[model samples]
Target: MFKKNKRISLLNYWTSRYLLTLFVGLAIISFISAAWIRHTTFQNRLEMMEFLADETVYRLTDTSGQNIGPMGSIPGFIGNRDRFTMREIDPILYVVDTEGNIVSSNRPAPPGSAKNVANLLDGEEGTKKITVTNEGQESVQYVVKKKLENNNKVVGWVLVLEKKENLTRVNQAYGQLALLIGALAVLGWCAIYSLSKRLAHPIKQVAEAAKQVQEGNYTFDLPQNNKEEEIYELVTSFKEMANKLEQLEKTRTELLAGVTHELKTPVTSISGLLQAVKDGVVRGQDASEFIQMALVETTKMKTMVGDLLAFNQFAVDAIPVKVENINVNQLIRDAVAQWEVMQDDETVKIQMDFLVKSVDVQADVVRTQQIVTNLLTNAKQAMQGGIVTITLMEKEDAVLINVSDTGRGIAQEEQAFIFERFYRGENKKYAVRGLGLGLSLSKMMAQSIGGDLRLIDSNSSGTCFEITLKKATTL
Candidate 1:
């Protein structure tokens, strides 16, 4: 019957809350504006009263230079029977001898101060705004009083009595205006809620669809068909994610087949080499050659196993580094030396520049060396037996260890997911073969030690990997 008003629904709740706030806010503003206008009108009335009070002054004195009109008329109530019309409302007029005596009142003054009202003109007068309260009543009145003058000396006052009823009427008028303002505010809020719900409905649908998409359903589409730029971008990003998922599925299938093939090659070689030896088909030289062939196959098997271990570690990754102060320059040199041992001097060259004075870094030395070694290996992998330059320096609060190579660098297409597991780069001439775990392990190791590794520069010359770490200043 009444929409149940269960105190919640996006529309009902938000609109209700907004309406409450709007009503309070508009009520205050409307009350203030209405009150101000009423007050300004009241003040104008006072100014008019002031003007009238100032103008009405006549003298009453005796033979020493006294005029007698004060005896004939009482201030602005010049005629004895003059009736007050609302058009000219102002000071009440009265006159008496210097001795207090009742003379005239436009209306009978309130009884409480009737006597005082009769004689108030006798005193010296300036314009005095006075409040009158009677003995047993709560209602009050304002009297604006000015002196009646005899040749510029005040002989009497012209007094005006305005009742509390007039102020009550002004307040009632303001109250009515406030009610109207409240109604208008409620109506305005309803309109806003209706319009905003229409505008926001599409967004809510998109949000639900996005959640569904995140949970592996890429079949969702935004219902909004208009040119809303942000929603359009959202839809585009979702479509992109869907496409990426499709490509990943295809890559996953290919990887499975490739890995099986890779495994079979080594297994087949090992089985054949062992069987040949067992069948006594070889003598001294042949046996040794077959034995080396089996050993190489076993080595490839070991490499594949290591890649699987690194992949598993990445999945549940551990940051098992004991932080200690180590010489940054020395660590780089050591990793470079290891690579130098693995290659002939004529085959490839290693260059080093230690930029800073001796500085210590909080790092796991083994992992740090591994990261540098992996980057150098990768740099060598991309080149034709060229020079790999490694640098270490302190920058402000961080230590930057850089490895740059001069070789055929990574393709722009391949650089993005270079850190992802099993992302083996394309190699030519079969020299740069790997199970594709080196960069991923290095990245994980770098992050574990509160550091980061990133490719800062690359072009026709090989890519540079910058490993940034907080300099261990105290150690």
Candidate 2:
């Protein structure tokens, strides 16, 4: 079996990685800085020694090669056995003649120190490293030399010798640098930790909110006000989504009840009427009337069932549409005339306005007629008596057919959901019995035929819906 990798919180994830990177970077910097500090310190010490050698030669001799005083009487000179503890380094000095003889000295030289004088040519002056073994222990030393001259001719040499052990003590500066680097690393880690926590806090809250939503609890507290722009947008968008899902959940429950009630009503009525006739509770004429009523209920039930099936088919794009070019003006007029004959109320008037005499569009004739008939029915039902107008206009490769009605218009809030499946408006939910699929189905049909249906305007004055159809290329 393969093991699943464990998940970690965002805070830990970011902080851990940042901490590792910070330390690695600091370590590399410290190493380079330490090496540079040690090298510079050694170079500075060598330069100081060279300066001392030059000064000693100047003080010990005049322009002509001759000693002004004994080396022990010179200022800043220490005896061979004198021990000084206040200075960082104490180098031994020796004055040697051009014949390689020791002329004056500050301290007795260690063994093998005089070998460097013999290696020097007549007036040569420079610094060199030499390893000297004293009392069975090996140690390195720096030897700096300056030429002693009389009238520009070489007379002797002044040498300053410093042990390598003394120069290695320069690491104290490296230690201080390491301390500063350590402090900065601590500060950096603290800043990174705090920032990671701030970023992870809001994300955790969102995750918790999502979990609650998954468990069907849509109401929960979230970090509403965030300073970060992206975090603010995420929280805001998630809140909106949760609210929409809640509304959909509530609508789903209501639709289920409505469907049950709508389907059961006719079934109950038919069953009761048939039982009454079978039990012979009325005479021949009464029996005929009850049977007619049962048949009417049966027909109503069948129509509702058919609407549900057709809607399901259309939703999945399973229904085929036949598209053809037809005269849009004539189509609307014919559809309105046929719908008018079926209405029981004569007070409801439908007025047609055509901007053009003849305009052809590519659309399914039956579906187009069905959309018009549905709009007329909704407009007529919206009020007791009102004018329902159908306006036709042509604009840039398309035809627009607007159906408007002067009714108690739709409620401002309810207007947004008119075309949602099984969504009945509050005003019509109880007064009118329907599954609320008329507009929804009509929209689906319109889109199926390379057309579209949308609400243009609605208020207390009236409501208008527009249907857009593709215009035929020719005739």
Candidate 3:
């Protein structure tokens, strides 16, 4: 098995990666800068040496090579002496003849150095630059040579030699560059760390909040004043989800209690009535009535159980729906007529308004009839006596079946949840005996047949529900 990777906080992850990148990038830049600085410094020093060599030759040639001494300085050449002094360069000066013999000197040099200088004299009469390491000291030196001329004739040479380390100030330049790079690196790390912390803080809080929510704690505080738009949206959406889950949890608890009470009531009634009859508490006609009451309770319980099972099957898409073309007007009329016959109360009247004489729709016949009957039953239960109107209208490749009732409409607050399973409105919770699955089941059945059932309107005046089905195409 592979080893699992260790988890890390966002702050550490981002900060470490950014810092590594920053340092690596800075390192590359520093390397380039240092290389360039070293080259430039050496070039500038070489130019200075050339200038000194030319100046020395100009002074010596003016005297016609006569006033030069062993020290290689013009005895009265104040300007030349000051130029060398101002530049602070201590270089060995030499005058070599055309025969490659040393003529004058700035200071006493080793025999090896004098031989190296002689070997460099190639009889050329123009200025030339060279780099060579002294054998005695084993240190590199920069040498510049200029020809000494008199009356436009070749005379000798003036050579100025300075140690390479003394000519170039690369170390000082590197020191300053290192300081600047360090400061920038420190500042960059601070900015990256601060920004990363700010971004990671909100995400950590959200993770913690999610853990709390998993533990059944829906209430928690989160940063609402985040300046980032995406972070603010994340926090806002999570809060809304938690609130919705909390509402669903409360509804679930209520539904469980309601289910227990609804099922237990009928069972208790049946048991009591049967026990009464079995104990010989009633006899003859009374005993028979008592037994009948028990059977009625038993039937009610069985109906409730059947509804629960059907709802579960429909929810899981386990029930098959056979859709076919049928005359919607006739189907509604027949369902209303059958439902009317079953209702014992005559005051509740149902009327049909057929806007189209004949309309064919693709739907499941049994499910359609069941949805209409369920709506009628709910309408009857909503009022003592009222008119339930069923209207059929055809429009734009679809047919609409509207079931309206002139009864007490659903309350404003409860209308949104009428189609939720096991959700009974406050007004009907105590007055009605049901599992609150009628509208929910009807909607599921309607949708399974490629149609929809929805509440179009509900108010204090009345309520209206519309069922939409696809119209059959004529070949």
Candidate 4:
């Protein structure tokens, strides 16, 4: 398998290449091997003939004036003459003399053969060559020879006829071995390529899955039935991760749907209630009730519109920042003062613990207050009949704040999507007077000012929203 950064790569280029290389390599090897074997056999046979040539030269000298062994009678005159032949290896061997007197007894012809070495007994020695026949009736050629000499003196000449049939057998054997080796090499190459392709198959699956995901098809299923358990494990983990992301996406879309319906409810209600009041269908105190209902609906509309607009503003590329240093404790107190005025809370309690003295941070004051205000409002809504705790602290290089609510805690599955725009929990409804953009906008705003907002902890102990900001630089 091939991979980069632990992700499988899709490329595979070895399949065709290995097969071709194997074929070429085998062909070259076989060609070399065949040539070597043939050369070795030819050299061994030729060496044996050369050794026999030395013995034949000795016999020509030792026999002196008469013929003996494989040679015919030596001549004392000079001119062209016929030679004698005997069957030895294949076609036969020839013996020609200085004067070319080929004796019948020295070079014996096959039984009942017509030639008796009679015409070859006396002929020319200065003619430089000689010829002999094996089956004279059939005119079958036996051997031909030219004069050979070592120095100024003339030495005997040799002519050995080779059968065409023996050569054909050697050629056939070499060809067969070469073909067999070639076949084996082809089969081996096929096996290697098949193995490489099979091993690389898992990578193909991973690549395909990635492509499907890119195309917005998140429901891709990995091949778990693969024999390699490690690949199966990798695919299983990928599927699980993708499924979780898909579910979180679905939740966010659901939240957006809820926000849209929430806005529509208020706009529709206000349009109806105000229309009745304006038309005088309700009079005096009844008219006032209708107006109040319309007011309540208008307030809900304002909250939804505000949250959405604020979230969108952070997402834009426009730069409208005006950063400055300010005491975070004072900043929170001022924000809480506005929230306190919005709702009278004699029945409920709100508290601020300024643990740090003069905790300062560098920020765009308006956006920083928006973040603090959003967290405070969210806590306030949750703790309708309970207590809300807000804290500000100064660390070494940053200021931190935490807001805690004694109301309903966030669910585990919903926590991951909490900072995504328009993502709300399952328990949330269109009547909640929130567009689900507050936390999302707050997180984005904090990040823009070199800060972050995150859930510190959430459970039955209540949810905590933690904020971190860079400590304000001292002059």
> Ten-residue segment with the worst summed lDDT in candidate 4?
77-86
- Clash pairs, model 4 backbone: 79-124, 79-125, 80-124, 81-124, 101-121
lDDT of 3 at 187: 99
TM-score to true structure, per model: 0.74, 0.67, 0.62, 0.55
lDDT of 3 by residue, 165-278 (tens): 776666778999999999999999999999999999999999999999999999899979999999999999998788767766777889889999999999999988888888
Report the Cα lDDT for residue 261, model 3: 93
Instruction: Spell out the clash pairs found in candidate 2.
Output: none
State the local distance difference test value for candidate 4.
Answer: 0.65
Residue-by-residue lDDT tens digits, candidate 2, 153-243: 7666787878887865665687799789989999999999999999999989999999999999999999777999999999999988887
What Cα-based lDDT does every candidate model obtain?
A: 0.68, 0.83, 0.83, 0.65
Question: Residue by residue across 332-445, what tens digits does model 1's lDDT show?
Answer: 777777767876556667888896588877788888878877887677667778887878877888899888888877777667667766666565214544556788788888
Model 1 poorest 10 in a row by lDDT: 55-64
Residue 393, model 4, lDDT: 72
What is the TM-score (0 to 1) of candidate 3? 0.62
lDDT of 4 by residue, 1-475 (tens): 8675653333335756676787788879887978777666554544444444444444445536443333333433221222222222333444544544443222344654334333433322222123444545433232233333444355445433333233222566577877898689878867886778776787778778878877868987677787778778878888877876687667666765776678888889999998888888988999999889999889878877866776677799354667788887787788777767777555447788995456678888888778877776776666657788888877789988888889788788777778877776665643355667778888888888888999998886688988898988877
Model 3's C-alpha root-mean-square deviation from the true structure amounts to 7.2
Q: What ranges in model 2 sit over 4 Å off? A: 1-7, 39-108, 120-170, 268-300, 314-317, 320-420, 438-475
